[model samples]
Target: MKRINTWLISTWAAIIGYFQFFPQDLNNLWQAMPDDIKASLPPYVAKGVAFALFCAMLIGRSVNTHKEKKVLEQKVEDTKDDAAA
Candidate 1:
């Protein structure tokens, strides 16, 4: 269980770190867009969209981590209470 947990954490970290480049990747994808499609959207829209997606990714991870930590904390408190009782 410990090894599996360690592996999961390492993989998760790698995934989160790679997401930091999402905006750059988005820019590259925008460059590859056909002219007609590009013309349909405003230039600044990409920046705004990139900001939102990246921010969501960051916040999502934090929220998930905190939720998990909270759950563990609750479980610990329950165990302590049981032991006291």
Candidate 2:
């Protein structure tokens, strides 16, 4: 129940809600791309790629947040050790 986990979960939930409610928005975005690009990727394939990218983004954010928290914790521990010396 870490704060970061909760935030990430809510954010992902919101994103899913948005797409569920406005699926056409995603299609609009897809259609706005160059015709050549659209031709390169069919709608289903494009959607899969977009989903994968979103998942990758979520994973990257989670890793970065945890790394930052770890570094901060390490800094605090070092400070404590230094103070005790």
Q: What is the TM-score of each candidate against the true structure?
A: 0.58, 0.61
Task: Please report, as a residue range, the 10-residue window in candidate 1 with the lowest summed lDDT.
Answer: 12-21
- lDDT by residue (tens digit), candidate 1, 2-85: 466556556655654654556576567778989998999986786666556656656766787789899999999999999999
Name the top lDDT candidate: 2
Clashing pairs in 2: none
Instruction: Please give the RMSD to the true structure for each candidate, in Å.
Output: 6.0, 4.6
lDDT of 2 by residue, 29-49 (tens): 888999998888788775576
Candidates in order have lDDT scores of 0.71, 0.79
lDDT of 2: 0.79
Q: Which stretches of candidate 1 lie over 4 Å from their true place?
A: 1-31
